[model samples]
Target: QEHGVSGMFTAPTAIRLLMGYGTEPAKPFDLHTLTRVFSAGEVLNPAAWEWMQKQLFHDRVPVVDHMWQTETGGPVFANPYGVSLLPIKPGGAGIPLPGIYAEIRTPEGAALPQGEKGIVVLTRPFPGLTPTIWADPAYIPHRLNGQSLNYQPPP
Candidate 1:
């Protein structure tokens, strides 16, 4: 486009909103400089992924979906497009990044088999994981203890 932006990171809701405008609005700009797109914050629904891949970017760039949290400090699951571009599985957050061990487990901490709903647990820590919240050392443990946790299918 105007700035010759090569990469973009965005939220799924933003993509969905753009989808509502259709493709015509973007026809006037050249998006060739764009190489890839990254989405996080919420589930990147398959419909939005498809529209961005097929209608917006014309399949020229990879649309990657990833997952992380403020507490995690970085992406836990992501398609490592910079390393090896994996096949896009619509609506899925890609595999755990290297050195980050993650599993879907029950509240009791037993690992759950694939396709079973369970809470995502990090079996080991990574450098990027936040060990403590600034000035709130006890917040994480307290909040976790009080919550009745559940899990849904992976985005």
Candidate 2:
């Protein structure tokens, strides 16, 4: 509240702690300065999400959850804030980022139908992903197999 931070992306644990502390000890600090809150790393429990939306911010701010990895460098699935304000799903991650060819594939490399859970794979290349995490591509065995592959954007 003191720093006037308008946005943040953090784990559910930290968000919960801050919310809990803000209400304790008689006076609640004003958190209206925060505009957007993004949660990742751990699941945002239903109870916490409800409390944050209903009790904490009074539905003024948006609490978003996205899924990504260090290899991807940014959110692969997230609510597009600037492009469009999509409906916020309580426990579901938002849609895939534009231009990303995301699919759920089985071990045999077959694409799974919607609502089925499988290994998430990128069938197309996007910027931000590094060509190699280590000195050699040999370090990534999954890249050699059909089950998984790395996306290298065309030069």
Candidate 3:
């Protein structure tokens, strides 16, 4: 608040800590200084999302969620902020960002239709990706070959 911070991207745990701090005994602080909060790295349960909305910001600031990992180097499923501000679904990660072609597949690799839970996979390349693992450069590619898959990360 001292620095006039307007937005932040953090894990759900951090938000929960701030929520705890705002309660009695601790000095009361207004969250209106914040305009947006982006969260990832864990499931933002519906109950927590509800608390973030009703109790945290009074439903004024948007709590956005996305899915990503160090390997992806960027978000595969995220709200396209610059393109447009889409509606928030309490516990849903927004649709795939432009240029990202992702799909869900069973443990055995068969594709599953939308709304079915499965492992997420990226079938196409995008920006900011490492081509090979650091420890074993040939391991990932060789394993893909053994599995009859040719998954290429972005250059």
Candidate 4:
């Protein structure tokens, strides 16, 4: 890289778009300075992740997928590349970050097993979670009345 950029954070849609251009367009650039790649906003499909890992970077860097929400403030599930390098799992939004109490549960509040489809719920409030949604005073009571904020993970 001309400017020695070390990392990149992008959306999966951008990666898929770049993938359509193929690997040839990337050959002219020296990307050795890049150390890691991050994806958010949407689920990163295995096919797109594979192309970025094997074809684009040739396994030189880890293409990490993470997920967050505006309500939660920052990333709740991530690879923690800065802490420890975990094994890359294509299409997975890595393990929960430290201090984040997260679990997948059924509609009736029963915890779901691993690999099961359910809503993602935060058992406790974490730092940075907005106490109230701005300009929506009525919605705050409903959200904070022991009601789980349901986030259905992609199938």
Model 1, runs deviating above 4 Å: 130-155
Error of 1 at 112 (Å): 1.2
Cα misplacement distance, residue 83 of candidate 3 (Å): 2.1
- Can you write out model 1's per-residue Cα lDDT over 1-155, one digit (the tens) per residue? 77999999999999999998999999998889999999999889999999999989889999999999888888989998888999999999999887577899998999999989999998765547655434445534553354522222122
Q: Over 4 Å off in model 2, which ranges?
A: 16-27, 131-155
Ranking by lDDT: 1, 4, 2, 3
Per-residue lDDT for 6-102 in model 2, tens only? 9978888876786676545424667777998888866677777777776777798998888777788887888887678799888777898864678
Q: What is the TM-score of each predicted model, taking all chains together?
A: 0.81, 0.73, 0.73, 0.81
* lDDT string, candidate 4, 1-155, tens digits: 87999999999999999998999999999998999999898889999999999999989999999989777788999899998989988988899886578899999999999989999998865545744434344434554455544322223
| C-alpha lDDT score of every prediction, in listed order | 0.84, 0.74, 0.73, 0.83
The predicted structure with the larger TM-score, 1 or 3, is 1
Separate clash counts for every candidate: 0, 0, 0, 1
User: Once all C-alphas are superposed, what RMSD does model 2 give against the true structure?
Assistant: 7.4
TM-score of 1: 0.81
Residue 148, candidate 3: alpha-carbon lDDT: 36
Misplaced by over 4 Å in model 3 are 18-27, 130-155
